[model samples]
Target: MNGQVMKKLLKIAVVAAFSFQSAIVSAKLEMIDRVVALVDSDVVLASELVRRTNSVLQQIKSRNQTAPPLDKLQAQILDRLILESLQMQMAKRVGVRVSDTELDSAITRIAEQNNLSIEQFRKSIEEEGTSWAIFREDIRAEIMVSRARGGSVSRRIKISDKEVDNLLVQIDNEGLSRVQYSLGHILLPLPEGASPEEITKIRDKADKLIRELRNGANFQEYAITYSAGQNALNGGNLGWRNASQLPTLFSGSVKNMKVGDISEPLRSGSGLHILHLIDSKGGFETHSVIQTHVRHILISPNAITDEKAAFDKLKLIRQRIVDGEKFEDLAIEFSDDKGSGSLGGDLKWSDPGTFVPEFTKAMEALAVNEMSEPVKTEFGWHLIEVLGRRNQDQTEEKKRERAYRILHNRKFEEEAQIWLQELKEQAYIKIIDEN
Candidate 1:
């Protein structure tokens, strides 16, 4: 009888231990893998969403703010992942890729921006508990996505000379200086697949909130309490935005409103929005522009001349120019910028923002008659010489350039919206876990 009781106890203990081990193993496997979302043929894994969410959570903590509920945050992150997956798929189909060399160069540029060397950047990421390899891959993916978006959007943007002229006239009518708005926003979200009654309720709620705001309620406090936007916790502040940069829905409304004015409830597909103007500045700022007259010998790398070779060649050319070689002769003989090379590399007088940021910055740093060290721009490696500087009255050329830029920006925003919506509507996106 004693032996039998002891055997029964031993059997029970073994069974319990095995069951516990199995559960531990099951949890570990589940934690590491699962499909969170599906974008057409591709899926966003649970692990990927969690990793990205953790990064955002860290940012929130560093800002000393309370994070939203994990499920809510995860759902939002999952949506982003779905979009990224779609874009990446498109990128793959279009044969868009960021090469290893490009990735390395981009990483190095980022490191330089952060005042660190590439190795130091790796150490910094490791110190922050992120893998360097993973970081590099993340950057490469970002570049791919950016390139993909550009490819999709650029083809759709069309600005004619007539459109540019019309934009310039509109700007001149509005006065050269325009008001930049700092806005406080409140969004009453319209749920996905919301019924007409539900939409009416949200819009009515927005109207009530707007009335309350007009009746002397604090806008920031109201935004925090009532807004369903991403910035609700931060009081729905849109920060300062030029009219051109404002959301298409808000821009027209904001343009007419004065500082400290509250807008009527504006309806959009996503939700009802109420905006309070916080402040206004600039657009009233005069264009006391300092113009620079500069010229450069540009050399773009081809299959025959790689980036390193182009850079080295420019460096030698710069040395020759410094050692009493005539810049115009060298530019005519060797520069690849056919238009400027034939003109002895003379770009002529240009106001600020006329050129790309890299070219502008390097040119600005050089004194009149001083030659820049081989500087790299989107076009290519450049050896710039600032011929002169002056304070000039705004010219038609400058006005036209500005108008083209403004029109391009406005049209780009409008087109981007239409394009992105079309992409999303056509894509097959399925959420594995809705909650």
Candidate 2:
């Protein structure tokens, strides 16, 4: 054969090999970025699902938590991705966004919390086999989801004053008000306006679940397999919340159950729940609540008696009281407060904010059964007596404020779960199985 012909054949062979190698590389990229799930107008890529699954697995390991099956974990991660895509789409529609500056600040704050610099944080993330770019995307996505969630869930939470007061009553009775419970929950959601038959069926399922959970069945696995709660993917972890912070339905069950004890199926507005008390920490917490039983003898300055006469009358009245004269008698005869005077000037037990600022200060300063000097209030010249002081009284304002927060959080949790379920039910989703 001619040398030219041999060289030409060799060059053609080399070109064909290079083309085949490029084709292999292209296939690899396609496999990595292939669509695993379609969520509304968005797609979750294979690479994303893999990354998220690995991250979750690592987190579970770090926390010493038992993970569910790989297939279950993957499905959970894919569902999460689909939900996140839906949220991001909603965020875009509503103009909810995290600016680059805000995102940077969030990242900086995370790093600071972890006691690391940005560069150090980047290195740490990369060391865990995640790219820095992907981590930023994760952070951005998290912020967008949070904003979207707040917009959707905040409106659903309506804490009525009566509801708050009810919660306060519960809190007051709760001996473990500040004790935190780390719970695992499995929700068996009922259909809207479910029939009695349906309710009984769900209750049976919940009861079975509680039995299994208490009898050494893997809670995380059961949760991933059956739970309808939003945190089902995270092994139904509701994380940590104090008794007051727990949902009203849950708080009652939790206080009596010991750690690792699973509650019998409990029903709420949403559905039946099987609760696993993963852990508990903390003890009783109480606020200093001081109440003073006070009585005031008010002598108003009238046209007949000038301010000086009123003041002098109060002084004389106070002197008479200090000289062992009957306060009730003086209050009835001279006190302008017709109602209180009739009751021996008995104001009963008063909370801190019950009185005017001046009156409250004077009352607060007086010891039990101690008489105050003639103090001038908006009412008139006053002779005040601290009949008794008690610390067990509830501060209505603070207690109500705490109750409001607890109710809001409970509402938020319940609402978010329902909202997510509705979102998935409403959206167009398609999962492309790897198989």
State the lDDT of candidate 1 residue by residue for 69-175, as single tens digits.
Answer: 67666666676677777788788789998989999999999999999988888998888777988999999998998889888888888879998777667667775
lDDT per residue as tens, model 2, 1-435: 534334544555665677668778775322224567767666777767888888888877876777877987787778778888888888878888788899999999999999999999999999999988888988998999899899888988887878877777767775446578999998888766789999999888887887777789989778876787778867789898887787778888998999888888887767888888989998655467677899989999999999999999899888888888999999999899999999999999877799888888898898887888988888888889999988864556666777788789878877877787778779989998768
Question: Who wins the TM-score comparison?
Answer: 2
- Name the lDDT value of residue 391 in candidate 2: 84
Error of 2 at 144 (Å): 1.3
Give the whole-model CA lDDT for all candidates, comma-separated: 0.78, 0.82
Task: State TM-scores per candidate.
Answer: 0.61, 0.65
> Which residue window of length 10 is worst by lDDT in model 1?
27-36
